[model samples]
Structure formats: C-alpha cells, structure tokens
Target: MKDFLRIKVLKMLIPNQKKELILKQMKDKMNKILNYFKNLVAKIRIGKANTEILDDITVEYYEKKINLYHIARIEVNHSNTILIKPWYTKILPAIEKSILKANLGLVTINNGKLIKIVIPNLTEERRKELIRMNTRKLEKAKIILRNIRKEYNQIIKFNIIDIDTVNIYKKHIDIVTREYICLIENIFNKKKQEIRRI
Candidate 1:
C-alpha cells in the first residue's frame, strides 16, 4: 500500500516537471530563430559603404572559391567608398571580378595594388524596392515561427497529459509565438525607416 501511494505521488509530480521542461525548450528555440533573423537583416545595406556589404562576394582564388574577406582587407574610406587591399597583388583582378559579378550596383576601381569601390546613393525608387525586399524576408521569418509553434502544439496535444495541463501549454506557446512575431515587426520597421532615410 505504501508503494502504491508513492507511485501515485510521483505520477502527479511528473506532469508539472514535463510542462516546465517543454516551456524552457520552446523559449530557447524561439530565441534562436530571432537571433537568426537579426543577422539576416544586418546584411542588407542602406546607401552607405559597409564592410559587410562584400560579405557575400566569393572570389575564385587558387582554384577554390573563397570569401572575399578571407583574402583581403576591406575598409570604409569615406561615407561612399570602400577600399580593398589584398595581401598578394596578383589576386587584385580576381577580387575585382568577384565584386562585379556580385552585382551590388557599386562601381569598382582597380589600380593593380588596391581596389576602390564607390557605393552610389540610393534613389527614391531604389529605396522602395529595398523596402519590399525587407518585407519579403520578414514574412519568411514569420512563417518559420508559425511552423515551429505548430510542431510544438502537436507534441503537447499527443502527450497523455490532462486537459488543463494541455490548455496551459497551448496558451504558453501562443504567447511565445506572439511575442516573437512582434519582435520581428519591430526590426522590420526600424530597417524600413533607415532605408527610407537614405
């Protein structure tokens, strides 16, 4: 009879412990998704010369494709120009070609030793296009968050927990999803404003 009572007590405790663990895991996953969206948005340029603007450019160096940053030093010379100086003079042509192929709407100057890039000012029409692009990216992020919430909901519903516990978990998941969606919107608005100001 003592063993039976102990077993009943442990069963009651397990549901609460499981609920806590699930909540923590959901929070962690949501945070990871938010961080990723931030990094993705940071790469979008807004009319100024930024080193990260060249991050996506890959140069064909020594029969292998490598990132431009790995083989050269990139610096912002002024509000509108970026200077790239490679360690080896021979790779200058390759770097120039890579930047041109990237098609970032910037002009490149190669003087055989150092490369100078001029970032053009954004026109009103260009600003509108950029804003649209930003919106598209944000929409994609929101979709990913929704998918994550759906998966977690399925997990909670399938478990053999009581109705009250299931309702609580579903509510927690909805709260977390709403919070992350709001964060994404805030980031989008900030970036859109910056692009328009440029």
Candidate 2:
C-alpha cells in the first residue's frame, strides 16, 4: 500500500500515459510469469527420457563450458533412455562426467563414440516428493500472479479517479489473472500425471 501511495503521488508529478498501455504491459508481465513457470517444471524428471532435463547441464568443450545440447545431439532412444552423440567423439568422457556431476540419479553409459543415459524408474516415495515440489512451485507462481494483480489494481484505482472505470479495470485484471492461474494449473496437472505414470 505504501508503495502504491508513493507511485500515486509520483503519477501526479509526471506525464500520464494511456491506461490501455498500462493494461497491455500487465498482460505481458503475466505471460512472462507463465513462461517462467513452464520452464521451471520442465526441468523436473518424471521417470521418462526428456532432453529438456539436460538443458541446464554444462560440459567442458575446448576448456570452455557449453550447454550439453549445444555440444551433442540428444535424442530419446526409448522411453527410458536418452542417447547423446557428441559432435566430437573425444568429448564423450567430459560429457559423461558432467552428467554424473549433475547428480540427477540417472545411469550414464559411455561407449567409445557416444553416451547413453538410462532414466531410472521413479519409486513411489520419489514420485510423491516430486509432486510436492511441483505443488510448491505452482503455489509460488499463483502468489506472484495475485501480487501482480494487486499492484495493477492499485495503479488503476489511483490513476483513474472514477469508481466505475477503476472497478472495470480491476475486474479485467482479475479475469486475466484467473486465466493465467488456470493455465498454470493445467500444466501442473499434466506434470503430476507424468510423475505418477511409473
């Protein structure tokens, strides 16, 4: 509220922009929130072979670290296997070592030319843990959306002195926020099912 008041006072001193532009900016921010949430959940392993799980792992290529996918061609050889063929066969050891260092609990088999990652089956306990982690992430995302809605609501309320206009903007913000929350929920539901699929 204090921050809203400060911004309200500042608005009086500065030139006002179109309210539609402010609403558009809020929608853009909400889209970013959803995208970030999707990326966060994509990294969670669910007893299947997904290349995105290795998106963060960096391997040493010519004394400089590079993303695992950049240095190699990663593919899903099977439901439980990820095949990695490095552009340079000599980097097999480095790639294998980097995957091991990541501690993702997968078995890495390095042949002379390529590396195979065998994703292990998720235990019941582990699946539940992953679900809980995803639930926490989902809650955090929703909290962010609510906070953003509150911030925008305050801005609209202070800037537009008319009660009807302020209520309309607040209502629109609420609707958009709910839509994003539903999207986040759908993603989380799909992920939860994946984690439980065994």
Candidate 3:
C-alpha cells in the first residue's frame, strides 16, 4: 500500500517537472531568435558611419580568410566617414577590396597607410527600399515565433497528464508568445524610425 501511494506521488510530480522543462526550453529558443533578429537589424545602416557596418566583411590575409576587425582598427572619423587602419600596411589593399566586394553602396579611398570610406546620404528612393527590406526580415521573425508556439502546443497536448494540465500549459505559452511578439514589434518600429531620420 505504501509503495502504491509513493508511485502515485511520483507520477504526479513527473508531469509538472516536464512542463517546467519544456517552458524553459521554449524561452531559451525564443531568446536566440530575438538575438538573431537584433543582429540583422544592426547590420542595416541608417545614413551613419558605424564600425559594426564592417563586421560582416572578411579580408584575405596570409592566405587565410580573416574578419576585418581582427586585422585592423575601424573608427568613424566623421558623421559619414569610416577609417580602417590595418596593423600591417601590406593588407591595406586587401581590406579595400573586401569592402568594395561587400557592395554596401559606399566608396573606399585607400591612401597607402589606411583606408577611408564615405557614407553617402540616402536618397528618398533608397529609404523606401530599406523599409521594404526591413519588413521582410520582420515577417521572417514572426514566422519563426509561430513555429515555436506550434511546437510547444504539440508537446503539451501529447505529454500532459490531463486536460486541465494541458490548459494551464497552453495559457502560459500564450502569455509568453504575446510578450515576445510585442518585443519584436517595438524593435522593428525603432529601426524604421532610425532609417527615416535625417
């Protein structure tokens, strides 16, 4: 009789444990998706010269591909100019070539010692294009969020102990989903404002 009661208690606790574990996993995955979206947004220039704009550019040095930041110092010399000074002057041309190939709509001036890039003012048409691109990225993030919700719902439906427990988990998942969606919307709005700013 004692053993039967203990078994019953264990069964009750296991489902709760599983629910907590699933919630934690869902939150971790959602955070990763949010960070990815933030990185994508960071790469979109807003008519300013930012060091992060060159973060994706890779230069060939010593017969190996290396990130631009690893070989040189990137700085914003002015509101619209970026200066890249390589530690070894020999790689100046290589860095210049990498930036050119990046096709970021910027012009590079290599002066033997350092490379300079001037960010041009965005025309009205370019601003519209950037907004459209941003909208696409926002849609992609929304789709990822929806997929995560679906996965959690499936897990809760299949593994939960009873209908009541399943409802609890579903409610919690809905709340979390709402919170993350709001966060993404706020980020998108801020980026749009930045792009439209003069």
TM-score of each: 0.76, 0.66, 0.73
Sorted on TM-score, best first, the list reads 1, 3, 2
Residues 1-198, model 2: lDDT tens digits: 988677867478423665567768788998999999999888886777888889889998878999988888999999999999998998899998899997667799988889999988888877887888889889999999999999888777666778987887788889889999999999999999888775
Q: How big is the positional error of residue 90 in model 3, measured in Å on the Cα after superposition?
A: 5.1
Cα misplacement distance, residue 139 of candidate 2 (Å): 3.0
Q: lDDT for each of the candidates?
A: 0.84, 0.86, 0.85
Task: Summing lDDT over every window of 10 consecutive residues in candidate 1, give the lowest-scoring window.
Answer: 6-15
The TM-score, computed over Cα atoms with residue i paired to residue i, of candidate 2 is 0.66
The digit string of per-residue lDDT tens for model 3 on 1-198 reads: 985674565456555586667678788999998998889887877778888889889999889999999999999999899999999999998999899997677889999999999988899987887888878888999889888998778766755658998899899898888888888888889989988885
* Model 3, C-alpha of 177: deviation from truth (Å): 2.0
lDDT, model 2, position 88? 92
Best by lDDT: 2
Worst 10 residues of 3 by lDDT: 6-15
- lDDT for residue 160 in candidate 2, whole number 0-100: 74
**Winner of 1 and 2 under TM-score:** 1
Q: Model 1 TM-score?
A: 0.76
